[model samples]
Target: MFWKTILIVFSIFLSILLYRAYVVFTPDKTIFESCLSSTANHSLKFDQNRLRTFQKLLQFQTISYEVNKQNFDEIKKCRNFIKEHYHDLVTNYSEFVDLYDIAEYSLLYSIQGKNLNLKPFLFSAHMDVVPARDLNRWKYPPFDAHTDKDFIYARGTLDDKGNLFAMMEALKEYLHAYGQPSRTFYVALTHNEEAGHSGAMGIAHHLSQQPFGHNGQFEFVLDEGTTILEEVFPTLNNPIAIIGVAEKGYMSIKYRIAMASGHSSMPSAPTAIGILARAVDKLESTLQPSQFGRGPELSLLHGVTPYLKFPLRLVMSNIWLFGPVIEWVLSRKPGTDALQRTSTAVTLISGGEKENILPTSASATVNLFNDFSNELEKSLSTAARKEPLDTTNYLACQCIVTEFIKIIRYTWLSKKDSSLEQSVFFSLNGYSTLNKMIELTVTRDKPVLASER
Candidate 1:
């Protein structure tokens, strides 16, 4: 009877989750056809000339790694190509286009408008393309810009260069056809967007150097984003355009774990690598608090609600009543979970140098895209663990360390052998500098981000 009761409860729980998943979102009218009515409906004629320029742009090897500029010649070649192609733009419209080259790599084209009455807008595009690692893996050469009929295959084709050129192509045609725009515009084509945001920072500094309210505040800024997705919603046959309402907050945390080092041949049980593995595993397993229902997820669901069919429509329409249930369902998915919680990713790790030697120290980098549930400060504070939220996973790693440290004690010729004695060493090391930095940033800027519910 007890087993039967447990089984029934489990079955009920499973049913509830399914029910919530099905009743996920509220229906709203599709905004696709409706948006064409606005000024955004302006005709953009991207001819063969534009397309060829785009392909040529892709051929330039504008690559960077972690703030370090790489392939300077190729990058300069690409910039020169832009200058040559947009000669009319640079020469005739020189004063208007303010072709200021900041950082020698970034292009900050500030187009001063005729009407000072209107607030200016900014167009952000990155010139840098990521390196194509292992040339053999690619179908055609990554830089070749191979084309047939349907698509142009290249490295920066999808991510950024395509968007950047599209903006330029549109502007080139628009400026040529219809002189100066009523409202001012700033075109920021950053050279270091792929690695360092130095280019963007340079542009900001340039703007600050200008007179107060130089271009006034912006009307609205547009960036490369979700173009359209037909299959995004469960029952929607319609294409959905995702307008980013908000951006997620970003933070990187570095942690170091230390243990006794010795020869690998001697084979210490709780070696540096072994202890680190346990700790990293625990960090991965211990998840953050989820905010699915009361977050931006509801807004996303609402956008697609109108297209949902049958009982699915009924479920979504009534999300208000079953929000927690929906949250539970959404939390099951990694993509959806990211929308709801402060995400954790162990990006970097370094432990040992040689195969034969056991290292004394291990370090890891944890990058988090923090949600703006309360604000940046509170969200990060909540994520920081004073108490282990996942006691089981936390204790499991500690237990593994405790047990293995015994075997290591014999090999290392250590003073303390008992688990309690060695537990102090197994404990985490706090870096004061990093702590102060994070605290200062959070307090000053309150850099927070989250999906709106």
Candidate 2:
């Protein structure tokens, strides 16, 4: 009788749990519609005339090419166009001048503000647009800046030109209204961010030498990065602007194995390609350990705590209560969980070309992001040691040859203050106009990761 009673109660509990899961996961159409309406009401008021000007800018074919000779004319035209339009703005400010010459196909422009004693504010954006791949795939011509009801469609619409034009518009408006800011604002438009920022480096080098301010430096710098998502968190009623506080450091390591080249009919016990493939498989299967202790991700979770449901809200608010749960969730997909931890991936592989002939050489490339606080050497060592590198079970005739791997590391450091976090939050809130419409009912569940992505 007791077992029967327990079973009935257990069934009721399971049904309730299932219902709650359904409630949590199901899409709320009303909320989505409301969000859409909100977005429409607060969308940027882009001027049609200004958009036409931008369209002309887009049509200029300022596509950056790797080889200077290939894109010479396009680059020259873009340079001249920028110089002519910005002449007035440049002439008004005394600090700006022609810094360097573009070798064949490149352009770099600089603008300085009126504050002599203050440190300069550098705002950079590239002029060149990526070449439209598979032109037939585009709804309209890639260069055609088409505007229907809302968006401006072009090759560079989101990648950068939209940002470039937005910055220019902001500057024009700022100059018209405020004359010049308390600090010097330097506007740098480079020709090749897509290619590799060779032009950007030239500009950066030039600015580094200049007497930008009283204390030898720039007060602040802003760059385009991750965008704001309105419903990333269920608890937050407003959009969350993710200002990339720190970007992941990257390192590439190459692994190579060699064996005797021979005919397929008389193959060695293990071929070079087989050995390398096995090593790669082993390395991939045994990934570096994940440590999700703390960082911007935790900060992000805390920032969105207000929007979470009852138990989740309570748990996320107090890390001690839900640390294990958070770790479990993050561990599921290391790539998605990478925001909170270091990640590794075996990205590329190269081996035998001819099917019949046994090739002697094979190689694999491993890419990884290490913890910020850890030293590069230590991280590299840790990665090397932890990753599987066994060569035991090879063919009898195959001589396993292993090459010493090279590790190349790159870091991006920021000098901005933490207050920028608040600024980002405020900017997103302003953009969303959520503060103004706080009283409006949000009837749907928050946007999921798939939707946000």
TM-score of each: 0.74, 0.68
Across residues 45-153, which tens digit of lDDT does each residue of candidate 1 receive? 5568767888999999888765565777888888878767877887887767768887787776778888877777777777787788998888898888998778888
Writing each residue's lDDT as its tens digit, candidate 2 over 1-453 gives 999999999999656654543443343445335443334323345777678768877777777555342354675686677667656565665444333454333444444445577666666566776678898888888887777886767887776767777877777656555565666565666666655434654455455546642235456666555687875544556676777665555555666656556899998755666656666776667655555555667766765665567566655666654677887776676544776555667888787869899876777777767554444455455554543334234221111111221212211212442333333222211111111100101111222232342
Model 2 ranges off by over 4 Å: 1-44, 60-73, 92-115, 129-137, 212-215, 307-309, 333-335, 386-453
Candidate 1 — which residues are off by over 4 angstroms?
1-46, 211-216, 265-268, 293-295, 374-453
- Deviation of model 1 at 328, angstroms: 2.5
In model 1, the worst 10-residue window by lDDT is 428-437
What's every prediction's RMSD, in angstroms? 14.0, 14.2
Candidate 2: C-alpha lDDT:
0.56
How many steric overlaps are in each model, in order?
A: 11, 3
Model-by-model lDDT, in order?
Answer: 0.62, 0.56
